[model samples]
Target chain A: MTSYHSINFAQKISKLDELWSPRVISEMNEYQFKAVRIQGDFIWHDHPETDEAFIVLQGRLRIDFRDGAVLIEAGEMFVVPKGVEHKPFAEEEVHLLLIEPRGTLNTGHAGGSRTKPNDLWL
Target chain B: MTSYHSINFAQKISKLDELWSPRVISEMNEYQFKAVRIQGDFIWHDHPETDEAFIVLQGRLRIDFRDGAVLIEAGEMFVVPKGVEHKPFAEEEVHLLLIEPRGTLNTGHAGGSRTKPNDLWL
Candidate 1:
């Protein structure tokens, strides 16, 4: 018998201790759904290979692009186009549901100490 | 000048007048994020090509399988594995955010009256 379970965003997010580190909660084919807690500012980077999605679960999130910025609050979402340089910022701690292809990095090609390991499942 | 905008689930869902008819709100790579309002029972179908994700935006949702069912509430999500036969039922009107690859049909291979048209954008 297959055990069916629902993935709760808040419950999964509660287990995330570090900021900006996304932990995989589920997968759809080659794509992955990750839960992350983020605050402060993130480095500007571009996913040259794929687009990235951000679903704000709590608090507000701001994604700054080269030309403009988008503010996403709870119950809101935004998609950053591939190859577009952008940075994420939050005034307070925010819970997010990120959807992207497997093996995609948080910092894209701008690898640094802030880059979290990929495929870290929760 | 580039225009940056956030996709609000409530705002987008407000435009969806038909039940079970998913309208595209955003796209990440080849995957499309659709907003749908549904109530009552759905048909049993399976997507042989890709998995389907359902994020409950409002009300409770239950996906019944051959053996068991998964109950998902507001602020929760569930991913139905590929090729798994399932049906969705809601006692009350429920709003959902569906994530799937482009051109994925709601009824999968179950070509009946319930099969909604693909790529309907809002």
Candidate 2:
């Protein structure tokens, strides 16, 4: 029988031990849904190939752009357009659901030590 | 300056007066994130061209397939594969976030009176 399980955001997020590291939870077409826990500031980066969506599951998220910043609280979301430089910061540990295409990196084109391997399932 | 506003799911869902009708909130690439309020049973349909993802923001949801059913509660999500017939039912009113490609109809190929206009923004 095909698995009819649902992906619980909080449940999957609880299993994530590393901050800034997102693990794939599900996929739709070529897009992927990832669960991640983040706190503090992230590196500035830009996905030249695809847009990135951030859905806040718990706590607040702030994405700083070149011109302004967006504050995303629980039950809120923001989408960063492709080729826009952004740096994400969280005051507290924030659980997030990131939706983007497969092979999209956490650090975008700003490859650094913070870059985690893609397609790591939770 | 570019708009730096975030989309609040609950705030958007509250503006919806019609049940089972989804309104576009934001877009990431070719995909759109829609907020909707739903209750009762939906028509059995399947998207042949792409998959559909449903993220429950409040209440419980049950998606019935030919062989099995998947129950998704608040903070949970499920992606119905392309060409898989499924019907969604909710015991009470449910706040939902739907992610699908642009121009996707709520009623898929089983279009009928239940098919609402696509791309209606909130």
Candidate 3:
């Protein structure tokens, strides 16, 4: 009856149907790990208090900063420091594993139509 | 002059020559993303204040608890709650991405000869 269970990112992400909407996969302490698939562009935003870690599972992601951009590929990871303005772009479908605090907003400071619930577990 | 760089887990791990030694790949907030290759047995230990997150990059990992055990596989993740005494075992070489606080010791409370410096970076 233990609640602890292992998560296979490949299998979990393959079952998702949405784009850019992250679903909580697991958690450790105050941090929650999420999975999301994306194509095209995500609005520029900034989270003033928390740094966000992104692990690329499939394809590639281009994170654009005011001064430059960083390309993250499969089996790779990138950490976007707090208080930094950035946008995400994917020329092709990309799968990602995001690690951050439990109550973090996906849209950061630019909450609007693209802002999705941060607590949806997969 | 930016210090930011994307880390490729597969490529980085392939360069390692030791076992059970973790290398820091990236950091977000106070937590760090580390990569390591482990096989055989790891001593039982506990981190009283911080939870440990383990994501298998390749191969499988078996975590043993006093009351139960959890088997983790490639592309899968598992979180060991804080203050829990546990040991890790791998039938073969296993690649892992460990997420925990900056000061976390891999050996946890079981510090001895098995304990290693927690700040090695890839």
Candidate 4:
């Protein structure tokens, strides 16, 4: 097993160049912690079995549900429930820490066009 | 089921007074997010089954393992693996976000004297 030192999220986020691509930073049991930079619109998708947690580290983000939307700013967090379809959008670039089960896809149900296959650790 | 709006971790943490007692802020699937203010020395303990994640939002924290210790600073995180006997100590007051299952107790095996039975939601 790989032992870990304490990790700095800000320092790791600074190293990322691609938007919407999530890099695994740490893991707890079966779950993985990911950091992602996103802007504009992301495809509408939902995980059928696992609930996804989104924590806004910097900037602003919006998760639009079918009937309404929730806006999350820095220092806030929101959990998108399982089987609930939602689209994530950011007018400006937003940094996010995502929590989900290991091997879970970013695009969820909708893939192909925007599916990012590679998962990196920082 | 209770639907959640985006939550601010900073604002919620600001309202805490008692140190070492954890408050539940959010939940995703079977897991829950908790905010805890800790200082000085904590009891040595270990969860027999679950892994615990510690994310330092402010100040500094150190987790002393049997062999070595991990020093976590602001914007940093560390995961204490299952069944590892560890002691958490912070020279200064540290703001922490802890992730675990819904009914996890702060003191895993060692309790009684330093056990906090009440769990609050902020």
Candidate 5:
């Protein structure tokens, strides 16, 4: 049987409304993951040197790239490897947790309407 | 303020026993993390090609090394980089979550008395 403080990703998603914002859930080593609610369009950005993992806890999100795009729904995850320019957006509000090294930038290169400040705890 | 589906590390530790064994709490990407309860004396081993993170959820655990030993307690985390020979043990029961790439070995260099099989969910 599975046991250990089970983090209810669904339960958390029901409690917020906003876009491109995240909340810290827990920390391991020097890295911690933040769950955020996102909607509409996020700014174009990329993390030049770190790989990040995004897990869809609810709704849907699409990542736009220079070459193509990919859509992700709840119960799915995508790893945006470092140095890849990508933009994330949604038709409706979506819930997600972003996993990466501590101090990772929310925006990669084009930091204009959506680059979030570092260490904003949800 | 902060809110999200909070996974209680302390609450999880109160529910299990045994050594080098783990329990799954969540899944992301193709990887999942399992929290394990461990105790006295494990065999020396090494993971040749993956970085593993160990977060001490409760009690105290010590990682034995070829030249030194590091003690980690609750609220502490240690990363054992790939290809390092090490052993983990505790004076009493210690709770932890081992994070690494999916399919990484529990026992790396030498697999004898303490190498755990892959995918044993707690």
Candidate 6:
């Protein structure tokens, strides 16, 4: 259930090191799910009008919500629904791909420290 | 651009023949993009609330819109925005996968001729 055909999750991790740089895997319409490498702490933010889904390719990632939190590991995924207040943090570098509508803003109500531009292909 | 790592587009086509049956490739959050083998004509319908995306894995598939039509081929993807009128047709067997919210309905405005149940693993 964790392994994907020819999908070398480890290989993808080898390709990048930046916190928010996403490399496109595939495109459906205007939306594309891309892989990224993250480490340490991330800015606190949320998407007011869009729901974002994250799938861990390697390592561990945590989404801190206003009330509770969710821990996602390799082979696991978590969806942050629209308008939820949250922040993402990682103890070590984690590789993940995010799926969401095109032109969605990375930061929702809290954008000062966490907003990221879209369509940066690795 | 056309091929995915360890991803077998051709092998998936050989596994099934029925229309609208989608097989999971990967999941992000609660949503998943699955590969499905489709053919002939589909029912006219629309998603009133959610936008649907289709990526042509093999063969040719057409999305009939209210005013015009969009043709998608292998390696190409199309997104049907919410509340749009559309019907899919294929001259031969067409393989594709849908990416959307987990509970999205296949038929938007029109249903009956088509309205597949969710979470059918291939």
In terms of DockQ, which candidate is strongest? Answer: 1
Better of 1 and 5 by lDDT: 1
In model 4, the Cα lDDT at residue A117 comes to 66
Of candidates 6 and 3, the better by DockQ: 3
Task: Please identify model 4 stretches exceeding 4 Å from their true place.
Answer: A1-4, B1-4
Tell me the tens digit of each residue's lDDT in model 6 across A1-122.
12112223345557776676666655554567677888887777777777787867678788887777777876455667677777888998888867776666655556574566666655
**Candidate 6 local distance difference test against the native:** 0.68
Q: Considering lDDT, where higher is better, how would the candidates rank from best to worst?
A: 1, 2, 3, 4, 5, 6
Q: After superposition, how far is residue B17 of candidate 3 from its true place, in Å?
A: 1.9
* Superposition error at A107 for model 3 (Å): 0.8
Give the 10-residue window scoring lowest on summed lDDT in candidate 5 chain A: A1-10
Per-residue lDDT tens digits for candidate 3, residues A1-122, read 35456888988998889999999988899999999999999999999999999999999999999888899999899899999998999999999999999999999978999999779999
**Candidate 1 lDDT by residue in tens digits, A1-122:** 56788999999999988899999999999999999999999999999999999999999999999898999999999998899999999999999999999999999999999998999999
- Clashes in model 4: which pairs? none
What digit string (tens of lDDT, one per residue) describes model 3 on residues B58-83? 99999998888999999899999899
lDDT of 1 at B113: 98
Scored against the true structure, residue B79 in model 2 reaches a CA lDDT of: 97
What DockQ class does candidate 1 belong to?
A: medium
User: Candidate 3, B97: how far from true, in Å?
Assistant: 0.7
Candidate 1 regions with alpha-carbon error over 4 angstroms? none
lDDT of 5 by residue, A70-117 (tens): 777764456776787878888998888777767777776676766667
- Pairwise lDDT winner, candidates 4 and 5: 4
Clash count per candidate? 0, 0, 0, 0, 5, 7
Candidate 5 lDDT score at position A14 = 58
Global lDDT scores for all candidate models: 0.95, 0.94, 0.91, 0.89, 0.69, 0.68
Worst 10 residues of 4 chain A by lDDT: A1-10
Q: Model 3 chain A, poorest ten-residue lDDT window?
A: A1-10
lDDT of 2 by residue, A71-119 (tens): 9999999999999999999999899999999999999989989999999
Clash pairs, model 6 backbone: A5-B6, A6-B5, A6-B6, A46-A108, B46-B108, B46-B109, B47-B108
